[model samples]
Target: MNRDSIFISHATPQDNEFSIWLTSRLEMLGYKVWIDKEGLLGGERFWVTIQQAIQSSAKVLFVYSKNIVTNEGILKQGIENEIEYAKSIALQFHIQDYIIPLHIDDSPYNLAIGLPNINHIPFNNNWAEGLKILKKKLEKDSIPQIFDTSKSVMAEWYENEYISNCSIIPKTELFYTSWWSVSDLPKEFYMYQFSNEVQAKAIRNSNQTIPVSLMSNVLSTFDAKLSFVVNRDDENIELKPVHTYIYSLNDILYGFESDKFPQHRDVENHFKRLLYRVVSNFLIYKGLWRNEMSNKRLAYFLPKYEKIKKIDFTYPYSNRKKSKSILGKFESIGMWHYAVSIQPMLFPFVGFSLKSHILFTSDGFKIIDDDKKQHSYRRKKGKRFFNEEWRDLLLAFLQRLKDDNEEIKIKVSQEGLVMKMKEWPEMFWSEVGYNDPNSKMDLDKIEDYYEEITEESND
Candidate 1:
């Protein structure tokens, strides 16, 4: 997009695969990204070409690698080139310091803390988010300036088909997904299509032209999402609907009580929807691991119910996976009303006696009991109460609800049970239908690709 080109300073032997992947993605995005693979190919003086590109470019991107710090290759390449270029250009041109370094979470760019003024984005969590960071960086008006000797670097780059301006950081393959925040997407509208990493880029760019395909033109199929949201104002995950669900907090914890008013606007029905959701989701996960059945393409699961709770305030980056099993159970019930557990542990509907007990549990939770009254449950023992008889359980619960309050209007929506993925990236990454031959990609299309994925083997 720019007149200037980017030089990718990277280690050769160690990061060969990553370098290849980064170049392809950048090219697809229509950016001129320079890497050693494209630039230092021929017998042309290696140092001369490197210095020329550094001189002309508006930007220099260091795909910082641990290997780069340790190994040395031709013409002081990798991190060294990136740093040298930054110093030379910044001092001469009045540039705003466009020398950028990207790194994984563990390694902060400064060789020493609080130094290097090195601005980098975290690539550990999500690939799409990381790409977002780099795109903004490249577009900034504050790019480092050009040097005099670098005057014709841009011209030389184009003449030799050299990449310029943008350089992809290493490790893009592991973390990126086609999914992104709703507001972050390029097109306001997109279609529904099932995709994996190899073809995810194709799905994203399919919307660029009008006559993409039948599926691309259909409409967005993102789902309601479940994530630990730091900012409540994120576009895909809005707070307004959450606020509505939060208002129903009282009924969810205790029990739906009927009143002269709206009775939580039908809390029990909502609860039933949530329960169906949970059961179906559990099945989906089990199914994924056991069979090659493909999950239906679905849109983001926007929180229809927002839950507000007293905060126990469990920050993430802590071990919370075990408890997620129980929390997932709640989500299945469709109780989207989310809450941060004020206590480290909470058992919903707790009962030592047979009267009442917590039915749902999740990871990262604490139980809060402000009221000291212990709930004791007692019922007529029916010799007829059989485990296999589901009707009995249904009748008993219905009778209990009826007795609790006649005003309580309970109507579970009759909508067919539709279960999308119950888990996040883990579930998405887990291979499903790979064993099934039908799940493979079209053979004709695979032949058309420059490099098809391992999906062909599965077919």
Candidate 2:
């Protein structure tokens, strides 16, 4: 037996030409549209057949016009009887949103008053184009899930090699999440985690939600500046960056430890390969692998090399220059005035250096020199900076989140109607605390917390 077809209920005997044209168009698009003139057969129990057709169809299309709505002859069969019967069948089966109205060259505004949110198609204005819109809306509204956008809404600027690698999802769901982009990166990459529907909508409407990439950049940027602003007194806590070392193999780096497990062996070999062309090294410690331990990290000497770069800057492109290591302060040396352009390569395992181009050696991402005498690392230049469009986009997004949070913290207070956040005893000697009288006692605790935070943040 054939499944029921999509029914087109219209005041059609008077408007027969339109019914033919409309049915023809729908048929071309492969919809088995049931027009009453073609559908009604002089058979046994015509009313039983009509009621069964109404119940089984996935969609009901009501084509409305000027004369048929008020005409008693048309209303008697199509609306007052047939369409009304279809709706009763829909209610019995608990079908929601089954009635879609296709409006014609009449008072379309007045015709659809007080009905449920009827999905209407503009048939009179542009016949083919209107049908296209109707078809898209019909297909989209039919889906069982929300955020089903059959039409293209996301921007194409985010469509390149970079986006494909990073997008956690395909096209963004419209009903699930609204467009809340701080950077021009595609909406497909952003989603608020939610345990339920209520929470999902709540986060979608909030300004506080921050992108993950932007958060990473802000922590990295602030680390450079806080180093200088903080070293005020001998009692004051001095911020020290957690030292990091990247092996040549792993894109991620490992800490200096003497373990000889398989994991450590992999990391050591990864970092060791950078040794060939990058920098000269001195031994920090020697390690023994695997005799007392499982087949873990291999035994090798950890090297102390020159710090080639200091990049303490925020998103929007700003950096700080500072030299830090055990050897430099004892020699009374200040930070080096290194060549500026090569600075970005100094990320990860930055060490102290007098030789120029040390930053490039660390992470210049070298290619063969072509003459084959040497391998030179790669550096971003010219359009490469502009091409960091993803990074820049990530920055702007984080700034919005930061700005919103700041606004939330600053509250208004009273006294002569003069508002101030400085109510914590104007001259009390300063330090970091929630309610403590002085900040002095908490400096060491704060420093330890800062170290832990930076470590976790870097990872």
Candidate 3:
């Protein structure tokens, strides 16, 4: 009749020995331990008995092993369902760490069920030490701290009466309108990087940096607003006033991935998790634009993706609404040809073939006309980019596979796909010559052509 039973949730037979030993050890520490082996009789309903044991137990200990992670048979043994029910009960009571994970093997953290980030108590190397740690944790029932607010009845009343009744309609409406306003862009930014060492020296000599207004003005040329700016720390040595610009990379990436169903929080979380892996010498420019960079010349340069080679640089003419049908089709077809000509330097995948064509829409690039068979080539929508950790891991892994054999295939993990952005270093800084405001490429003429195209299309 012990109500303080600690339930051991594990795969039977495989984990049978460990469960038996753990039960005995916990019982020795003055705890009532419940295992399916001892709790259920022959005639008992299997599910009802499990539910009752789980309900009666104060804590659920998930026993993790190598077998549990890889063996499908073990998962089919009904322990996953028990974990699910335990999670449900924990959620109902608003519990934290109600189900503790104990590890008996060195499986990857991501492999453990319902415990990706949680630090599990390791019993792999030293069982006695892990048991001691568990004993200490369970000494006081592991109750979460709750602040007593019995004397704050008036405080609660004030919040309920004033804050709850406050009208936030105007603020909420303003947010929606502001988002759409920034989102509506007439031109795409086509960024280009320059290691223009000559220009770098000139900036250093002048002891001056690009004006803060430069970024906004450049964005406005395309009728776009500032989205996210990743500043280079060492650039402060040169003191670029433009580096002061700061916005959430998470928000910008989510807007790119999905206009209909954006996972804002997920984007935020992944960026935060992988922020430390980013080196200090890089910058990212994100905003509402049809292209990655513009024809306007500028001083600052965006970082280049060192890994990718022969990226498709051309974009759809900004004023597509005004272009003649023949001209538009020609331009679009030209872009598709350019896209097909490019090849991935790091990951070799046959993308632009005879059957498939790359289409440049207003928002971003798409590879279509192949019955959606280009999943391997394109980044899945809603995935954030610039994951340094994942990229490093994948490259190393791929190289290892290549070393083993000439042609080998391996299953792609979620981490690999999540960091797979379609085209990285998507925008480059508007590169120009030293002391000359204009570059050798003549961006002004390019701009003029776009203007003329727009006018003709309008006519």
Candidate 4:
């Protein structure tokens, strides 16, 4: 049976043209449509083919016209037969909308004869308006399952990979977690807990209802940013953290932990390979899986330059002028800066580097080297630096720095911008160097800058 098909039942010559046109339109929208002239081939029995087509179709479009009501039942017997069969099946299955009544010219008909109480889709001469109504009804009547989209891939991964790995599912309690990101919002939107729909609703909806479609789309966009597949059993959909290793195998660098430090070069490489897989997964999620950026690829783009070339990592530390495990370049471009950093290789803890590039836009930063791009979530229309996104990122940064955690860091240039964000009293004392009441990074300086910018804008 063709579940994605629609069967059209209509009277002769008068309705034939409309049926043909509707069939073409439905076919274009990815629906397999069946009409008498289209479905009936030379040798096939008419009634048998009609019955088969009706049985196969998920919906039936019964076209109504002045001729049907005005004529004696004998003239449109085939269409009447199709409607009777459809009505019987529809009633047996308790389906209310199996047959979609389509009408033109709003001709009055006593629907009590058949298709009683069923709503009609008015497709009167205006095909455009009719198509819109038809398309919406088709979509609403179709499958309830989530479509396979690039945006839903992460959610699917979270459901499959992440959920399958979990041994237990949490219930009846809210727990703070990270790793799963709700997209279309700032990165900080994921940094909270919710035990039920109410909590979820509370977080997003203060007074207005937050559209789940928008939330889902935005969240799917950041699925790669999610380091771990969110455990399905987790009542609150707790996002699991993506972990990396350093001087150890299975040592959780980002979320959870289990350390295994190996001394042998071959064993170390084995662990490094595993860690690279994790990073590669994230890179894929970030949409940056280019051949040039692959771990095995020996060549790397020179940080500030567009030039792609191989660089030697064998030079000894003290003898070389630039002898750091990590190499990076920062170049200013207009109000933004293009920054590229080559992280030191993991295995030998010596020379190999994974080159990554980032673009620091005026409002936020974006990772440009990977297939999955990660960006700072910033509000486009809002107060200069006092929006929720800014506060969330700032607070997350301050919390990390306050705890002396290596998980997060502040860029010097970006921190200067942060200092300027001190117009908000809550944010003022939280500035990096503002721990001391008397400090060089003064609150007054931020106030002065804020006033200057405000004055300039007003002028």
Best by lDDT, which number?
4
Candidate 1: deviation at residue 233, Å?
A: 53
Between 2 and 4, whose lDDT is larger? Answer: 4
lDDT, model 2: 0.34
How many clashes does the backbone of model 4 have?
13
Index of the highest-TM-score prediction = 1
Q: How accurate is candidate 4 locally (lDDT)?
A: 0.40
**What does candidate 4's lDDT look like per residue over 1-459, in tens digits?**
335567888766566546655654455445566677633212333798888888877788888777564345343566678888988877777765898878754566564275546788876544434556777787788722222334432234334533355424444322221121111112211222234434443333321211111121111111113222233355434332222113322331223333542224433344334333333333333223232333455221112223322222221222532212112333322122212222324333322232233232222222244232212211111112222223233223222222134222111111121101111112111112211122111111223333443343356
Tens-place lDDT per residue, model 2, 24-130, is: 44554445655554332212335666667776676777776764566432343445465677677668777676777777554444543434366567765444445
Candidate 1 regions exceeding 4 Å error are 1-3, 38-45, 71-78, 112-115, 142-459
lDDT for residue 50 in candidate 1, whole number 0-100: 72
* RMSD in Å for all candidates: 24.9, 29.1, 28.0, 27.6
Q: Indicate the residue-level lDDT of 202 in model 1.
A: 41
Q: Report the number of backbone clashes for model 2.
A: 21
Which has the better lDDT: candidate 2, or candidate 3? 3
Which portions of model 2 miss their true places by more than 4 Å?
1-4, 38-45, 71-74, 108-117, 142-459
